[model samples]
Target: MNNTSVEKNLANKTVFPILFAISFSHLLNDTIQSLIPAIYPVIKHTFSLSFSQIGLITLVFQLSSSLLQPFVGLYTDKKPQPYSLALGMSFTLTGLVLLSLSANYHMMLLSVALVGLGSSIFHPEASRIAHSASGGKRGLAQSIFQLGGNAGSSLGPLLAAWIIVPYGQFSVIWFSTIALLAIIILTFVGNWYKGMVGVIKKNSHSITAISPFSKRKVVFSVSILLVLIFSKYFYMASLTSYFTFYMIDKFHVSVQSSQFYLFVFLFSVAAGTLIGGPVGDRFGRKYVIWFSILGTAPFALLLPHANLFWTTVLIVPIGVILASAFSAILVYAQELIPGKVGLVAGLFFGFAFGMGGIGSAIMGKLADETSISHVFFLCSFLPLIGLLTGLLPNIEGDRKKIKSNK
Candidate 1:
């Protein structure tokens, strides 16, 4: 019943089945979400949309995705919602159906917004579940969970190329099947989450804990993490929202070919995602964060100047290095504010989305004003902001040492 015993119990209670279930659901959820961006070229051509309009569509989707996550996480921290995951997927299903039927740009926005809302609902609670099942391997758990999303993201363009590009917009309804399967899977996850809540309630007395750092230190650390998120996601916004267009514009590649190229980058991201968490768990998150964020700089700086062959080669390392930071960053923030896992996840995730949205909107306008090539050249410097990593406190290293001593 004591704190030590409770800690041991929680540490030893990592439930891999639940972890895998939640991670699978994450994959399904993100795969559905990525479909929006995947079909952008089709939508642009069909609707005669400007680059600005394209950006606005992303703005709407990203805003809807980002704005509500913190509130959802904060609310659920107080009142856990086991079945919210399934309910969220229903929104995505509806969105996918609506996207297929949409006749106008406005309707497209509405459909994407619905999908974004589903994501807002899904992430916080699912993240909490991952944290609970971490079994003292929080970074690895987060990495597993995130690997699903990155993989899902990689799948989106391939699926779009195969399904939407050739068959046209209405074919999108086929993807609703993905959402349906996610709903069924999430229902099971919800049941497990509900049971976990009951167990937590039974052991509530032994679960009390406090942040190891002072509030000011925690706040400072969280700020630094947010900056890192800003750097990572903003740069990501450029790649995710415009990389295809860049490829097409610069190299005159076919849309399908661009999608394939994008897939290469995103697949690299998935591969890199698997590395950060376990590495952070073993070596310390601060080091992982420093290396992951700053390490991408050389490749990013070189990307805008590279030819088609070299561009293809460079993006792989760029994706791999840059993609590793999020899991480490998220887990570090969670550690800084120990008991507020849901809140930390929501804040960081939401901010990342918000930055991506904002960055997309701005870059869209920039591309409109100048060119996609110029936009990439400008964003090449964003990774240099990773120098701020020097300011982050070294809590993870200290914790690892303590654990080793114990």
Candidate 2:
């Protein structure tokens, strides 16, 4: 219960049981989150919505999700709220129920907003929990945590295609069961977190973080990382928000088939998430970030010109390559700003969601004004921003130098 005891407790080997529990909870959380976007087509028809309207829905949901995260992370870094996880999921459950029962546009917005609110709460604490339980295996822990989310995300479209698309709007209520299950899992995780509350007062300040770079260099590096995030998530917005429509419009694919294709892309993403962290742990995170983002450029450039079959093939590499970047980027940022795990997680996750929202809105309008093909073409250039990876100071290398000096 004392500070030294707490440090010893926390510094022990990675707690795999706690890690997997949180990862499974993340899967349940994101599975519910993904439902909103997945059901867009059905709701578009039911409510006679426009592409811009769809973008606005994302905007609202994302704002609610993004805006609160930094503050939530900051607050929890101070207080370490053990039970907030379940509280957050309760909001999602309410949102799910409302979304299922929603008969009008405004109500739908409110429902999605509530769901977004739940996400803003969940990520920082969950991420902190993963970090706390990581011992020394930061990258691997983050990857395992993210794998659940990507896997859950990949399930959304497929589940929507099977469940909601056929059963109609009311069937979204069925996913309330998913939300409830998450709440149960989160409650269990919360109990574990409660036991760690002995570290609260010293948690945010006790650890001495040594940065190899100057404050200016660190700030500049963070800006570059943000830019990279913009590139990755903006391009991601094109695919996650509109890929199905793009498929139907260009290839004349059925809605179900488009959903199936989206599943393939997201499943590849899940696979990549599993790879990024461990590889970053083995190699330098800078290399992982460089390869993951920049590596996607070739396939992205080829995507607009490919036929339906080729497009499907291209999305696999796109998803896999692009998906690897986030885990590395996040872990790299945490290394940069050590001990502020919640803030780092919240900032990056919030910014990623913000970029995705803004990107979706801008691209939706672009698709309305130009064509989805044009939108895809323009977005293809985004991965090129990964070139900024050259500028980041090598944290791992710097740490090795520090140790040798010691």
Candidate 3:
């Protein structure tokens, strides 16, 4: 009879259509975001930038993107904003235009900060939408959502190699079209979300997950997760922000060839993203978190020492293995604080970005003071931080066992 009635009649089952729609929007949004770093080589050369300056660009961008997400998530958790996703896209569109026209370093920084602002608005609300539509399949929904982002990220380097490099900086203007398309799709999604908001608000209190840990235990576990995120993203920064440079510096690969290598590693990330969520749903998020972060240790340790061919080969497993951790970690955190989905998403995503930004800056400085090879060698030890995952209390196992006994 009404919005609430309409929502109630449909079983709380997964909404595939909406899931796919949001995921596609994610792909579009991240494609635009990835362009900034994708064209780093071009910008670096065009501006006569040092590694520290390059890293500062990323730091500024990431800080803008990361800083607002938690606040946005917290605010939206209290008061949902359906059309904000579209609004975020508008910011991205503006940024894309400015970036294409950027004539100097300051202009580039300003352009990326605008794009980062858009991302700050996008992730939290989008994550909430995915969680709401999940219908108990949180991990799978998150993975599907994440797969699109990773896929889009992988495309950036490849596209930059083809478009930005050949045609020059002006070519970035073309991706403004991608941001525009995302805005349109997000409008449609916004309409659907508008209708669902009433129902979602009513059902919010019932969305509690059963956690077996005490409050102190939950907080401790979350701290462990954050530490794990720092380790993961710190390591990831070396590859994502510097791997292309590393390739050119060490192997004497052409700039275009280096981008192709970056693309391969990123594509592996997209492929591995499918593993964590569904597997976590079946097995346990903790186990997935453990293997995903720690399993990469062997591969990562070998990566910096390998020859060019082997370096490329080793990056695949490193990317794939490390890529699996986030979905598991995010879902696990959501489960930790049952009702604060938005806050958890915001906190985790924001922290990841912050770590990445910080890591890039530090690595850049290290590379400048020493060498890119030294940076890679030092980062190789980061995955070993996964050992702290053992400190995570097995909340999933406890919840299952308690239910079975009852």
Whole-model lDDT per candidate: 0.89, 0.90, 0.91
Give the TM-score of each candidate: 0.95, 0.97, 0.97
Query: What does the lDDT read for residue 84 in candidate 2?
Result: 95
Please give the range of 10 consecutive residues that has the lowest summed lDDT in model 2. Answer: 198-207
Question: In candidate 3, how many Å is residue 59 off?
Answer: 0.2
Root-mean-square deviation of every model: 2.4, 1.7, 1.6
lDDT of 3: 0.91
Give the true-structure RMSD of model 2: 1.7
| Best-performing candidate as measured by lDDT | 3
- Give the clashing residue pairs of candidate 3, or none: none
Query: What does the lDDT read for residue 285 in candidate 2?
Result: 95
Per-residue lDDT tens digits of candidate 3, residues 100-148?
Answer: 9999999999999999999999999999999888888899999999998
Comparing 2 with 3 on lDDT, the higher-scoring candidate is 3
Instruction: Please identify model 3 stretches exceeding 4 Å from their true place.
Output: 1-11, 209-211, 404-406
